[model samples]
Target: MQSDPAAMPAPAGPRENRAVLVDVALALVIGWILGAAAQVAHWSGQLAPGRRHGPGPTGNEAGHDWPRWAEGMGQPPPGVPWPALIAAVVILLAVALRRAYPRAAFAGALVGAIGYVAAGAPFPVTLIPLALCGYAVAGREPLLRWLPIGVLVLPLAVAGWWQEAAVGLTEPGPYGVLLITAAVLASATMLALLRRARRDAHDRERREELRQAALGERLRVAREVHDIVGHSLSVISLQAGVALRVLERRPDEAAAALRAIRGSSTSALTELRQTIAAFRDDPGRGPTAPPPGLDRVDELAAALRAAGREVTVERWPDPLGPLPASIELAAFRIVQESLTNVVRHTDRAGAAVLLRRTGDELLVEVADDGPPLAAEPTPGGGLHGMRERAEGAGGTFAARRGERGGWVVSARLPIGEAP
Candidate 1:
């Protein structure tokens, strides 16, 4: 019995699930760290008095020199009960949605960054979520779409700095902040592009592998169809010719030949349908019938004898032990093709088939005792296919003129036993 190909297990789900989990966990961890840092900076600002206006007693601020938007305003800044809570929620939401909806998450993160700046937060705190979102967007979106967005970072930073300057609230480090923001965005975009390129390379390699595998399967099926139809048609053609020649003198013999032709045609049609169905990917078609093998050799010899050829088969190891079906099929095809060649190329030739198993190898040999034909036989698809089948089964095949002056074909197939 043949097993259904559809019954094989699928391996895609678990790997994809694991990747999603990893991305989500990493996002959460990064969001947590950024939120904690923002909270610490907010607390430091609250504890220091007049520090936003000028340097502290140490002649330097606790954070970098970026201008603070809240310090220059005449009115006191509105207080939030939990400033970190808003930033944390926004950052986490953006990260969680990054993989599934990258563009939306990226836009949300940009809005959050603008809100952070407007709320008088530190510049470094605003950068965390923006950088993460930029990376996500670059990874998913095409270069033409995301590259321009990345380039806009420089102009946006300059505009914000210019607004601060118009109000006489600009610090001496406007260019420093602009360059830093641009560098962050550029670096994130470049890394994401590299990752996308690597993923594309891997996808291409996988597709190539699948294509080559499909091509190899096609060749294998073609070879099988060629051997089956070729051998069967050869037998049928020879039988039809015999039936035509004897139709006038021997009516009974002609009838028998016609019956043999019908039998061969019917068997070929059945096998052709099975071969085609095997190639179909539909599970509803069910299992295919087992392929022909050594057990059918007797039926093959009988058919040839009925077609006016004298053929003998010998099995030295009678009641042969179990063998792999592939080896058996290759063996059967070699013998079948050899007999078919004899019928086509020789007149009244008698052939002998010998099958023997010794140790780890199964041997098959076919020899004909007829005199050489007037023309030398040219190698054709049959000979090339036989060699391929034997080698594909991890076996060896040879065809040459025998010492007794007739064509001999031989093959030795490995039986999966330890050598």
Candidate 2:
């Protein structure tokens, strides 16, 4: 079964969801390990929840006497309490959104950082959320998200510096550094995935367009095949049947009918070959010379005139001058096909052909005194073929009923005025 074009797969779906889930789990694991390590290492000096020491330092306040958990300078210096728990949660959130809702995870990390700072979390623990937010937001969201991230950075950095000051130089603990690395990696990975998605979308669009064009071309070829074979065979069949039925009575008419059958069969064979050849090789690259051009306008007009119809021809001096072969061929085909349609469909036997150069444009117009076919509302393939020729040559073609009940086919080809 052919798939509906509208139901094609979108760029985001099940795979993306799975990736997000994995990222979240990984983040949670990382956060848990970090929190547990800090707690067990005495990083926050085991301050029991809601327990207050007797006498505090000079600047330390009564209720805000720097909880042991929140006492670290910048990072949550390897210790566990309420702060460690929150930071770990933030990490898990960041991981969850790494693939899917990156922006949400990014914002959540920043919020988690603030929560950790206010709750007197370890200095190292706070930095984790800050790094996560900065890395996440900068890559995906607008730069405005950076403002809040920037606000979080100041406190986190200060705390880190304070801790470094408290502990002597060369305190190479993996606190701020690890968070920065993780954030950078996350941002890069996110950007890479985004780029891949865009490229995939672009490829899909291109393929769809080509597929549509190819289908249209196939339909056109089918119609042409019908016109060539069906029309020819129908004419031959009718003539042969007439000839067979009237052979004993109307000898002369039967002979004429037999000749017409022979003629139609020959023409059909030729047309069939041409149609099959077109399938194997594009005419543009074939040995066949391009179609007729503006020079043939008078001949086309004369042919119509000879058939008991009046034809008038107007030409701009050298409008057919050394033009690109493609343009010349296109203009010729447009006028030829238009004239052929007039011959086959219109009641009027004659038409006028006009070709003029207006500045940088060439205009070809074929107008007939024939009324539009009210019953056959759909435009025929001949007219469509002419329009395609004009458009393929970087021009515009229009065919409409004229004010005087006649029909007009006009095509404008923008030119560069041949040197």
Candidate 3:
């Protein structure tokens, strides 16, 4: 089915439409008030005698006919020096329509200005409507679209000034019209540029926010993948080595080692699927299981032991109680990554895991009594990941060589309301 292009809905949202309506309405009301004031000045004779271009007498004793300037330029039709109320209505309508149809509104306003001048209208409130239309045009249309309008309006304005001056109404020159036109165009252009700059700043801010969100999400996925795959693979490697060593004599032990490897691999696969589902934004699926935390430190230590490391866990103050889930998860990952590093780099090194609460902070430390690995760690490796995880959870992490001659990793995590 064919659809008419003219029937398409505007891209502006409801909020933007309302804002435009309010602005246009305010401009209309302001123009009407100014026009009304000019009408009062005309009635009170505050303005010059011949300035009112109406059909009635100009109050001049000579009783001259219509001015020569009114010959070529069209005059308002009969009964056309509209009352203040009718003029106000026309001005209001023309100003209000400026936004959606800037060119048409501006042209209509210019015609109205000509009629108002020919009618000898008391005050030139029409200039307000024209200026507003120019502003709207400058804001929405490109320079090429409205630049010609500016160029054309200046000459017409100069002619109007010349007519006023020729009749002894004001000083004779194009300078007055030139000044007014320049002011109007400059004001409109400045406002339009400011609005454009503000919108550009807002757009840049919005794009930056989206980019940061995406980067954070990617970092989260990377952290999860590292913790799950790295830990499971480390366990599988140890079990596979045990199985190969025992296959000749201890058949049952070898079989047990193979079963452990199967369990670790299965667990790794399940977690990987969950991570993938999360990335795909699946509604029905959530995290497959709660994240490992401090409560699972013993299980983690046992796994490290199985990986051929001597591991000891010490908890200060007996019962550590419950902590925030984020803190617990960060602590667990720190210990897990530390253990993994020891297993991968050290040969049966002894490591200690410590958890303690002091003041408003929970401290977690992992240290291995082995020389640092000779291989240079890659950027954003296990240690860097652990530090990011801890700091991102509103904590502080530090890793340094222990006084006893081994690498030590420590994190001080806030428990509650601690800076």
lDDT (C-alpha, whole model) for all candidates: 0.74, 0.61, 0.71
Better of 1 and 2 by TM-score: 1
**TM-score of each predicted structure versus truth:** 0.76, 0.41, 0.77
Give the least accurate 10-residue stretch of model 1, judged by summed lDDT. Answer: 46-55
Q: What is candidate 1's lDDT per residue for 1-419, written digit by digit as tens?
A: 99888997666588767867876786688667656655555543532111143335332244333224344544433444264547556767777777777777776666555444433445566566678788889999986765555544544344334334342235544456567777887788889999999999999999999999999899889887987898899889888989999999999999999999999999999998998887888978778998888999998898889888899999978967788988898999899888888887787888999999988899999999888534445678888888988999999988888766578889999998521
Q: Model 2's lDDT to the true fold?
A: 0.61
Residue-by-residue lDDT tens digits, candidate 3, 125-212: 5567767877777777787876766655644454333345454335433455556656876897789878977988999999999999
What's the best-to-worst order under lDDT? 1, 3, 2
Candidate 1 deviant stretches above 4 angstroms: 1-78, 81-93, 155-172, 277-288, 369-379, 404-406, 417-419
Candidate 3 worst ten-residue window by lDDT: 60-69
- Cα displacement (Å) at residue 21, model 3: 3.4
Best by TM-score: 3
- The RMSD of every model to the true structure, in order and in angstroms, is 7.2, 12.2, 6.3
Stronger candidate by lDDT (2 vs 3): 3
